[model samples]
Target: MAQQKPTKVMKLYNRVTRLPYGNKIFSLMVSRMAPYFGTIRPLITELRPHYCECLIKKRNAVHNHIKTVHVIAICNGLEMAMGVMAEASIPSHLRWIPKGMSLDYTAKAGSDIRCVAEVKPEQWVEGDLLVPVTAYDDNDVVVVEGHIKLWISAKPPR
Candidate 1:
Protein backbone atom coordinates (compact mmCIF):
# COMPACT_ATOMS: atom_id res chain seq x y z
CA MET A 1 0.00 0.00 0.00
CA ALA A 2 1.12 3.57 -0.68
CA GLN A 3 1.76 5.95 2.16
CA GLN A 4 -1.13 8.32 2.63
CA LYS A 5 -0.47 12.00 2.27
CA PRO A 6 -1.97 14.76 4.39
CA THR A 7 -5.10 16.51 3.14
CA LYS A 8 -4.75 19.78 1.27
CA VAL A 9 -6.42 21.70 4.06
CA MET A 10 -4.14 20.21 6.72
CA LYS A 11 -1.04 20.98 4.66
CA LEU A 12 -2.13 24.54 3.99
CA TYR A 13 -2.99 25.17 7.62
CA ASN A 14 0.32 23.81 8.87
CA ARG A 15 2.52 25.36 6.19
CA VAL A 16 0.94 28.80 6.06
CA THR A 17 -0.01 29.36 9.70
CA ARG A 18 2.94 27.40 11.23
CA LEU A 19 0.82 27.58 14.41
CA PRO A 20 2.40 30.93 15.25
CA TYR A 21 0.23 33.66 13.78
CA GLY A 22 -2.88 31.75 14.84
CA ASN A 23 -6.22 32.90 13.41
CA LYS A 24 -4.66 35.74 11.41
CA ILE A 25 -2.79 33.34 9.15
CA PHE A 26 -5.81 31.13 8.75
CA SER A 27 -8.04 34.06 7.79
CA LEU A 28 -5.51 35.23 5.23
CA MET A 29 -5.04 31.78 3.70
CA VAL A 30 -8.73 31.00 3.44
CA SER A 31 -9.54 34.38 1.91
CA ARG A 32 -6.69 34.09 -0.56
CA MET A 33 -7.63 30.58 -1.67
CA ALA A 34 -11.36 31.22 -1.74
CA PRO A 35 -12.32 34.73 -2.72
CA TYR A 36 -15.88 34.23 -1.52
CA PHE A 37 -14.66 33.49 1.97
CA GLY A 38 -12.82 36.80 1.87
CA THR A 39 -16.07 38.67 1.45
CA ILE A 40 -17.09 37.70 4.97
CA ARG A 41 -13.56 37.87 6.43
CA PRO A 42 -13.86 34.94 8.84
CA LEU A 43 -11.13 34.18 11.35
CA ILE A 44 -10.69 30.48 12.08
CA THR A 45 -10.58 29.84 15.82
CA GLU A 46 -10.27 26.06 15.61
CA LEU A 47 -9.66 23.50 12.88
CA ARG A 48 -9.49 19.72 12.99
CA PRO A 49 -10.82 16.67 11.15
CA HIS A 50 -13.86 16.33 13.41
CA TYR A 51 -14.55 20.04 13.96
CA CYS A 52 -13.95 23.53 12.52
CA GLU A 53 -14.75 26.91 14.03
CA CYS A 54 -14.60 30.45 12.62
CA LEU A 55 -15.47 34.00 13.67
CA ILE A 56 -16.94 36.76 11.55
CA LYS A 57 -16.75 40.30 12.80
CA LYS A 58 -19.70 42.64 12.76
CA ARG A 59 -18.46 44.97 10.09
CA ASN A 60 -20.33 47.34 7.82
CA ALA A 61 -19.59 45.11 4.87
CA VAL A 62 -21.51 42.31 6.50
CA HIS A 63 -24.14 44.40 8.22
CA ASN A 64 -27.82 44.20 7.54
CA HIS A 65 -30.53 46.85 7.25
CA ILE A 66 -31.15 46.58 10.97
CA LYS A 67 -27.45 47.20 11.75
CA THR A 68 -26.92 43.54 12.50
CA VAL A 69 -24.96 40.84 10.73
CA HIS A 70 -26.59 40.04 7.43
CA VAL A 71 -28.30 36.69 7.00
CA ILE A 72 -26.25 35.90 3.91
CA ALA A 73 -23.06 36.77 5.75
CA ILE A 74 -23.97 34.35 8.52
CA CYS A 75 -24.53 31.67 5.90
CA ASN A 76 -21.15 32.41 4.40
CA GLY A 77 -19.50 31.86 7.77
CA LEU A 78 -21.32 28.54 8.13
CA GLU A 79 -20.15 27.41 4.68
CA MET A 80 -16.56 28.39 5.40
CA ALA A 81 -16.55 26.35 8.59
CA MET A 82 -18.13 23.37 6.85
CA GLY A 83 -15.74 23.60 3.87
CA VAL A 84 -12.70 23.48 6.13
CA MET A 85 -14.14 20.62 8.18
CA ALA A 86 -14.87 18.54 5.10
CA GLU A 87 -11.46 19.13 3.56
CA ALA A 88 -9.70 18.10 6.72
CA SER A 89 -11.91 15.11 7.61
CA ILE A 90 -12.64 13.34 4.33
CA PRO A 91 -10.68 10.24 3.42
CA SER A 92 -7.63 10.77 1.20
CA HIS A 93 -9.04 8.53 -1.56
CA LEU A 94 -12.35 10.31 -1.58
CA ARG A 95 -13.46 13.72 -2.87
CA TRP A 96 -16.36 15.88 -1.73
CA ILE A 97 -18.41 18.85 -2.94
CA PRO A 98 -21.17 21.02 -1.51
CA LYS A 99 -24.40 19.71 -3.01
CA GLY A 100 -26.86 22.08 -1.29
CA MET A 101 -27.75 23.77 1.99
CA SER A 102 -30.68 24.55 4.30
CA LEU A 103 -30.56 27.30 6.90
CA ASP A 104 -32.71 28.74 9.66
CA TYR A 105 -32.17 32.19 11.10
CA THR A 106 -32.97 31.69 14.73
CA ALA A 107 -32.01 34.99 16.34
CA LYS A 108 -30.63 38.46 15.74
CA ALA A 109 -26.89 38.71 15.35
CA GLY A 110 -25.86 42.10 16.70
CA SER A 111 -22.21 41.33 17.35
CA ASP A 112 -19.40 39.20 16.05
CA ILE A 113 -20.52 35.71 15.05
CA ARG A 114 -18.94 32.33 15.64
CA CYS A 115 -19.59 29.48 13.27
CA VAL A 116 -18.81 25.81 13.83
CA ALA A 117 -19.05 22.62 11.81
CA GLU A 118 -18.65 19.00 12.90
CA VAL A 119 -18.85 15.48 11.51
CA LYS A 120 -18.13 11.93 12.67
CA PRO A 121 -15.76 9.51 10.87
CA GLU A 122 -18.59 7.09 10.25
CA GLN A 123 -20.35 9.75 8.20
CA TRP A 124 -17.70 9.53 5.50
CA VAL A 125 -19.04 7.24 2.79
CA GLU A 126 -19.53 7.36 -0.97
CA GLY A 127 -22.87 9.06 -0.97
CA ASP A 128 -24.77 12.16 0.05
CA LEU A 129 -24.34 13.36 3.62
CA LEU A 130 -25.68 16.32 5.53
CA VAL A 131 -23.19 18.15 7.73
CA PRO A 132 -24.50 20.27 10.59
CA VAL A 133 -23.26 23.84 10.91
CA THR A 134 -24.23 26.39 13.54
CA ALA A 135 -23.49 30.05 14.13
CA TYR A 136 -23.70 31.91 17.44
CA ASP A 137 -23.51 35.48 18.54
CA ASP A 138 -21.21 37.02 21.11
CA ASN A 139 -23.86 36.26 23.71
CA ASP A 140 -23.51 32.56 22.91
CA VAL A 141 -27.02 32.40 21.51
CA VAL A 142 -27.54 30.45 18.33
CA VAL A 143 -28.15 32.92 15.52
CA VAL A 144 -28.25 30.40 12.70
CA GLU A 145 -28.62 26.68 12.17
CA GLY A 146 -28.04 24.86 8.92
CA HIS A 147 -26.96 21.68 7.16
CA ILE A 148 -24.74 21.49 4.13
CA LYS A 149 -25.25 18.50 1.86
CA LEU A 150 -21.97 17.14 0.57
CA TRP A 151 -21.52 14.69 -2.27
CA ILE A 152 -18.65 12.28 -1.70
CA SER A 153 -16.95 10.13 -4.34
CA ALA A 154 -13.71 8.34 -5.18
CA LYS A 155 -11.00 10.24 -7.01
CA PRO A 156 -10.38 9.02 -10.54
CA PRO A 157 -6.94 7.74 -11.59
CA ARG A 158 -4.50 10.42 -12.59
Candidate 2:
Protein backbone atom coordinates (compact mmCIF):
# COMPACT_ATOMS: atom_id res chain seq x y z
CA MET A 1 0.00 0.00 0.00
CA ALA A 2 1.13 3.54 -0.63
CA GLN A 3 1.88 5.91 2.24
CA GLN A 4 -0.88 8.42 2.78
CA LYS A 5 -0.34 12.14 2.75
CA PRO A 6 -0.97 14.22 5.88
CA THR A 7 -4.40 15.71 6.33
CA LYS A 8 -4.98 19.37 5.51
CA VAL A 9 -5.32 20.24 9.18
CA MET A 10 -1.95 18.68 9.89
CA LYS A 11 -0.39 20.41 6.92
CA LEU A 12 -1.61 23.75 8.23
CA TYR A 13 -0.29 22.99 11.67
CA ASN A 14 3.13 22.03 10.34
CA ARG A 15 3.32 25.13 8.22
CA VAL A 16 2.44 27.64 10.92
CA THR A 17 4.24 25.98 13.82
CA ARG A 18 7.58 26.45 12.02
CA LEU A 19 7.54 30.25 12.03
CA PRO A 20 7.87 32.70 14.89
CA TYR A 21 4.56 33.36 16.69
CA GLY A 22 3.39 30.08 15.19
CA ASN A 23 1.68 28.93 18.33
CA LYS A 24 -0.43 32.07 18.42
CA ILE A 25 -1.24 31.69 14.76
CA PHE A 26 -2.21 28.05 15.20
CA SER A 27 -4.46 28.93 18.14
CA LEU A 28 -6.21 31.59 16.11
CA MET A 29 -6.61 29.17 13.21
CA VAL A 30 -8.10 26.51 15.46
CA SER A 31 -10.56 28.97 16.93
CA ARG A 32 -11.59 30.02 13.45
CA MET A 33 -12.01 26.42 12.37
CA ALA A 34 -14.17 25.64 15.40
CA PRO A 35 -15.85 28.71 16.76
CA TYR A 36 -17.23 26.92 19.80
CA PHE A 37 -13.71 25.97 20.83
CA GLY A 38 -12.76 29.62 20.80
CA THR A 39 -15.08 30.28 23.72
CA ILE A 40 -12.72 28.49 26.08
CA ARG A 41 -9.78 30.67 25.07
CA PRO A 42 -7.46 27.73 24.48
CA LEU A 43 -3.84 27.95 23.51
CA ILE A 44 -2.55 25.23 21.24
CA THR A 45 0.76 24.38 22.82
CA GLU A 46 1.52 21.34 20.72
CA LEU A 47 0.10 19.51 17.73
CA ARG A 48 1.44 16.39 16.08
CA PRO A 49 0.32 13.02 14.80
CA HIS A 50 -1.22 10.96 17.61
CA TYR A 51 -0.70 13.72 20.15
CA CYS A 52 -2.01 17.19 20.93
CA GLU A 53 -1.69 19.54 23.90
CA CYS A 54 -3.50 22.73 24.86
CA LEU A 55 -3.48 25.18 27.73
CA ILE A 56 -6.42 27.02 29.17
CA LYS A 57 -5.85 29.67 31.78
CA LYS A 58 -7.84 30.04 34.94
CA ARG A 59 -9.92 33.09 34.32
CA ASN A 60 -13.22 34.51 35.42
CA ALA A 61 -14.85 33.54 32.16
CA VAL A 62 -14.00 29.89 32.70
CA HIS A 63 -14.31 29.72 36.46
CA ASN A 64 -17.10 28.26 38.47
CA HIS A 65 -18.70 29.67 41.61
CA ILE A 66 -16.01 28.04 43.70
CA LYS A 67 -13.36 30.07 41.87
CA THR A 68 -11.90 27.03 40.12
CA VAL A 69 -12.03 26.04 36.51
CA HIS A 70 -15.46 24.86 35.50
CA VAL A 71 -16.01 21.26 34.50
CA ILE A 72 -17.47 22.27 31.16
CA ALA A 73 -14.42 24.36 30.43
CA ILE A 74 -12.22 21.40 31.16
CA CYS A 75 -14.34 19.26 28.89
CA ASN A 76 -13.96 21.80 26.14
CA GLY A 77 -10.19 21.69 26.55
CA LEU A 78 -10.18 17.90 26.39
CA GLU A 79 -12.20 17.85 23.20
CA MET A 80 -9.94 20.42 21.62
CA ALA A 81 -6.89 18.27 22.29
CA MET A 82 -8.58 15.15 20.98
CA GLY A 83 -9.88 16.92 17.92
CA VAL A 84 -6.43 18.14 17.00
CA MET A 85 -4.95 14.69 17.52
CA ALA A 86 -7.55 13.07 15.31
CA GLU A 87 -7.09 15.66 12.62
CA ALA A 88 -3.33 15.26 12.58
CA SER A 89 -3.16 11.48 12.88
CA ILE A 90 -5.99 10.05 10.78
CA PRO A 91 -4.83 8.81 7.37
CA SER A 92 -5.65 10.86 4.30
CA HIS A 93 -8.07 8.27 2.91
CA LEU A 94 -10.16 8.35 6.08
CA ARG A 95 -12.40 11.04 7.56
CA TRP A 96 -13.46 11.32 11.19
CA ILE A 97 -15.96 13.00 13.47
CA PRO A 98 -16.31 12.92 17.22
CA LYS A 99 -19.06 10.52 18.25
CA GLY A 100 -19.01 11.16 21.99
CA MET A 101 -16.87 11.48 25.09
CA SER A 102 -16.50 9.65 28.40
CA LEU A 103 -14.93 11.77 31.08
CA ASP A 104 -14.08 11.93 34.79
CA TYR A 105 -13.25 14.98 36.84
CA THR A 106 -10.47 13.67 39.01
CA ALA A 107 -9.61 16.84 40.90
CA LYS A 108 -10.34 20.52 41.22
CA ALA A 109 -8.41 22.67 38.79
CA GLY A 110 -7.01 25.52 40.86
CA SER A 111 -4.66 26.92 38.27
CA ASP A 112 -4.18 27.04 34.55
CA ILE A 113 -4.80 23.65 32.99
CA ARG A 114 -2.97 21.78 30.28
CA CYS A 115 -4.83 19.11 28.38
CA VAL A 116 -3.24 16.34 26.39
CA ALA A 117 -4.73 13.66 24.17
CA GLU A 118 -3.24 10.71 22.36
CA VAL A 119 -3.94 7.59 20.33
CA LYS A 120 -1.47 4.74 20.33
CA PRO A 121 0.22 3.96 17.02
CA GLU A 122 -1.35 0.52 17.02
CA GLN A 123 -4.80 1.94 17.59
CA TRP A 124 -4.99 3.84 14.31
CA VAL A 125 -7.46 2.12 12.01
CA GLU A 126 -10.48 2.69 9.79
CA GLY A 127 -13.41 2.43 12.16
CA ASP A 128 -14.63 3.56 15.55
CA LEU A 129 -11.78 4.50 17.86
CA LEU A 130 -11.34 6.05 21.28
CA VAL A 131 -8.66 8.62 21.96
CA PRO A 132 -7.55 9.09 25.55
CA VAL A 133 -7.17 12.57 27.04
CA THR A 134 -5.89 13.92 30.32
CA ALA A 135 -5.74 17.35 31.89
CA TYR A 136 -3.36 18.61 34.54
CA ASP A 137 -3.07 21.77 36.55
CA ASP A 138 0.09 23.87 36.77
CA ASN A 139 1.02 21.74 39.74
CA ASP A 140 0.95 18.62 37.56
CA VAL A 141 -1.99 16.95 39.23
CA VAL A 142 -4.26 15.07 36.90
CA VAL A 143 -7.55 16.95 37.02
CA VAL A 144 -9.39 15.02 34.34
CA GLU A 145 -9.16 11.75 32.41
CA GLY A 146 -11.28 10.26 29.70
CA HIS A 147 -11.60 9.19 26.09
CA ILE A 148 -13.24 10.76 23.06
CA LYS A 149 -14.78 8.42 20.51
CA LEU A 150 -14.38 9.22 16.86
CA TRP A 151 -16.09 7.47 13.96
CA ILE A 152 -13.58 6.99 11.17
CA SER A 153 -14.28 5.79 7.63
CA ALA A 154 -13.17 6.05 4.03
CA LYS A 155 -14.61 8.92 2.06
CA PRO A 156 -17.34 8.01 -0.40
CA PRO A 157 -16.20 7.85 -4.01
CA ARG A 158 -16.64 11.19 -5.67
Candidate 3:
Protein backbone atom coordinates (compact mmCIF):
# COMPACT_ATOMS: atom_id res chain seq x y z
CA MET A 1 0.00 0.00 0.00
CA ALA A 2 1.12 3.55 -0.70
CA GLN A 3 1.84 6.01 2.08
CA GLN A 4 -0.98 8.49 2.55
CA LYS A 5 -0.41 12.20 2.14
CA PRO A 6 -0.55 14.34 5.23
CA THR A 7 -3.58 16.54 5.82
CA LYS A 8 -3.37 20.20 4.81
CA VAL A 9 -3.10 21.37 8.41
CA MET A 10 -0.32 18.87 9.09
CA LYS A 11 1.54 19.98 5.99
CA LEU A 12 1.29 23.61 7.05
CA TYR A 13 2.47 22.78 10.56
CA ASN A 14 5.47 20.88 9.17
CA ARG A 15 6.44 23.81 6.95
CA VAL A 16 6.05 26.53 9.58
CA THR A 17 7.60 24.67 12.52
CA ARG A 18 10.99 24.93 10.83
CA LEU A 19 11.29 28.71 10.96
CA PRO A 20 12.15 30.90 13.94
CA TYR A 21 9.04 31.47 16.12
CA GLY A 22 7.40 28.87 13.93
CA ASN A 23 5.14 27.51 16.60
CA LYS A 24 3.94 31.00 17.39
CA ILE A 25 3.25 31.65 13.76
CA PHE A 26 1.37 28.39 13.42
CA SER A 27 -0.68 29.22 16.51
CA LEU A 28 -1.59 32.58 15.10
CA MET A 29 -2.64 31.01 11.84
CA VAL A 30 -4.80 28.50 13.67
CA SER A 31 -6.42 31.23 15.74
CA ARG A 32 -7.21 33.11 12.58
CA MET A 33 -8.71 30.02 11.01
CA ALA A 34 -10.95 29.53 14.04
CA PRO A 35 -11.41 32.90 15.64
CA TYR A 36 -12.83 31.49 18.89
CA PHE A 37 -9.43 29.97 19.66
CA GLY A 38 -8.02 33.50 19.54
CA THR A 39 -9.84 34.21 22.79
CA ILE A 40 -7.31 32.19 24.81
CA ARG A 41 -4.32 33.42 22.84
CA PRO A 42 -2.98 29.87 22.81
CA LEU A 43 0.56 29.05 21.83
CA ILE A 44 0.93 25.62 20.34
CA THR A 45 4.22 24.28 21.67
CA GLU A 46 4.18 20.90 20.00
CA LEU A 47 2.31 18.98 17.33
CA ARG A 48 2.71 15.49 15.92
CA PRO A 49 0.78 12.41 15.02
CA HIS A 50 -1.37 11.34 18.00
CA TYR A 51 -0.44 14.26 20.24
CA CYS A 52 -0.53 18.05 20.64
CA GLU A 53 0.41 20.48 23.39
CA CYS A 54 -0.61 24.10 23.89
CA LEU A 55 0.11 26.83 26.39
CA ILE A 56 -2.31 29.45 27.66
CA LYS A 57 -0.92 32.34 29.61
CA LYS A 58 -2.71 33.40 32.77
CA ARG A 59 -3.70 36.88 31.78
CA ASN A 60 -6.48 39.08 33.17
CA ALA A 61 -8.56 38.38 30.13
CA VAL A 62 -8.71 34.69 30.94
CA HIS A 63 -9.13 35.05 34.68
CA ASN A 64 -12.22 34.36 36.70
CA HIS A 65 -13.83 36.66 39.30
CA ILE A 66 -11.73 34.99 42.01
CA LYS A 67 -8.55 35.77 40.00
CA THR A 68 -7.67 32.28 38.82
CA VAL A 69 -7.85 31.07 35.25
CA HIS A 70 -11.40 30.31 34.20
CA VAL A 71 -12.48 26.73 33.59
CA ILE A 72 -13.95 27.64 30.22
CA ALA A 73 -10.67 29.16 29.15
CA ILE A 74 -8.90 25.90 29.96
CA CYS A 75 -11.61 24.04 28.06
CA ASN A 76 -10.90 26.16 25.01
CA GLY A 77 -7.23 25.27 25.19
CA LEU A 78 -8.02 21.58 25.61
CA GLU A 79 -10.37 21.62 22.63
CA MET A 80 -7.80 23.33 20.47
CA ALA A 81 -5.22 20.69 21.28
CA MET A 82 -7.67 17.89 20.54
CA GLY A 83 -8.79 19.39 17.25
CA VAL A 84 -5.28 19.85 15.97
CA MET A 85 -4.17 16.41 17.04
CA ALA A 86 -7.11 14.79 15.27
CA GLU A 87 -6.41 16.77 12.14
CA ALA A 88 -2.79 15.71 12.16
CA SER A 89 -3.29 12.08 13.08
CA ILE A 90 -6.45 10.89 11.34
CA PRO A 91 -6.17 8.47 8.46
CA SER A 92 -6.27 10.08 5.02
CA HIS A 93 -9.60 8.48 4.29
CA LEU A 94 -11.18 9.54 7.58
CA ARG A 95 -12.43 12.80 9.09
CA TRP A 96 -13.38 13.70 12.67
CA ILE A 97 -15.44 16.15 14.69
CA PRO A 98 -15.80 16.57 18.42
CA LYS A 99 -19.08 15.19 19.75
CA GLY A 100 -18.81 16.21 23.39
CA MET A 101 -16.41 16.59 26.29
CA SER A 102 -16.56 15.29 29.85
CA LEU A 103 -14.20 17.05 32.23
CA ASP A 104 -13.50 17.32 35.93
CA TYR A 105 -12.00 20.39 37.55
CA THR A 106 -9.32 18.91 39.75
CA ALA A 107 -7.67 22.03 41.10
CA LYS A 108 -7.48 25.78 40.76
CA ALA A 109 -5.75 27.02 37.63
CA GLY A 110 -3.60 29.64 39.35
CA SER A 111 -0.97 30.19 36.69
CA ASP A 112 -0.11 29.58 33.11
CA ILE A 113 -1.53 26.28 31.94
CA ARG A 114 -0.38 23.61 29.56
CA CYS A 115 -3.04 21.59 27.74
CA VAL A 116 -2.38 18.25 26.13
CA ALA A 117 -4.39 15.82 23.97
CA GLU A 118 -3.42 12.33 22.93
CA VAL A 119 -4.78 9.40 20.93
CA LYS A 120 -3.32 5.95 20.61
CA PRO A 121 -2.37 4.80 17.11
CA GLU A 122 -4.94 2.03 17.18
CA GLN A 123 -7.74 4.40 18.18
CA TRP A 124 -7.85 6.17 14.83
CA VAL A 125 -10.38 3.85 13.20
CA GLU A 126 -13.93 4.92 12.34
CA GLY A 127 -16.41 5.30 15.22
CA ASP A 128 -16.38 7.34 18.40
CA LEU A 129 -12.79 8.03 19.45
CA LEU A 130 -12.37 9.47 22.91
CA VAL A 131 -9.26 11.63 22.97
CA PRO A 132 -7.79 12.06 26.39
CA VAL A 133 -6.99 15.63 27.47
CA THR A 134 -5.45 17.19 30.52
CA ALA A 135 -4.41 20.64 31.73
CA TYR A 136 -1.76 21.48 34.28
CA ASP A 137 -0.80 24.70 36.00
CA ASP A 138 2.74 26.06 36.18
CA ASN A 139 3.43 24.10 39.34
CA ASP A 140 2.60 20.89 37.41
CA VAL A 141 -0.62 20.39 39.29
CA VAL A 142 -3.42 18.83 37.32
CA VAL A 143 -6.13 21.43 36.99
CA VAL A 144 -8.45 19.57 34.72
CA GLU A 145 -8.74 16.12 33.20
CA GLY A 146 -11.14 14.93 30.53
CA HIS A 147 -11.79 13.24 27.24
CA ILE A 148 -13.25 14.76 24.09
CA LYS A 149 -15.39 12.35 22.17
CA LEU A 150 -14.86 12.57 18.43
CA TRP A 151 -16.98 11.05 15.71
CA ILE A 152 -14.74 9.61 12.99
CA SER A 153 -15.96 8.47 9.65
CA ALA A 154 -14.94 7.85 6.05
CA LYS A 155 -14.82 10.88 3.82
CA PRO A 156 -17.49 11.17 1.16
CA PRO A 157 -16.36 10.65 -2.42
CA ARG A 158 -15.80 13.68 -4.60
* TM-score leader: 3
- Measured against the true structure, the TM-scores of the candidates, in listed sequence, are 0.91, 0.93, 0.95
lDDT of 3 by residue, 1-158 (tens): 34557878889999999999999999999999899999999999999888999999999999999999999999999999999988888888899988999999999999999999998878888999999999999989999999999999999998
Tens-digit lDDT string for candidate 2 (37-98):
99888999988788999999999999999999998999999999998888888776678888
Q: What is the C-alpha RMSD of each candidate to the true structure, in Å?
A: 2.4, 1.5, 1.5
In model 3, pairs of residues that clash are none
Displacement of the residue 59 alpha carbon in candidate 1, Å: 1.4
Instruction: Specify the poorest-scoring 10-residue window by lDDT in model 2.
Output: 1-10
Model 2, residue 100: C-alpha shift (Å)? 1.2
Best by lDDT: 3
List lDDT for all candidates, in order.
0.88, 0.89, 0.94
Q: Arrange candidates by TM-score, descending.
A: 3, 2, 1
What is the C-alpha local distance difference test score of candidate 3?
0.94
lDDT: worst 10-residue window of model 1: 1-10
lDDT of 1 by residue, 21-91 (tens): 76788778788888999999889988877689999999999998899999999999999999988887788
In candidate 2, stretches whose alpha carbon ends up further than 4 angstroms from where it belongs are 1-4
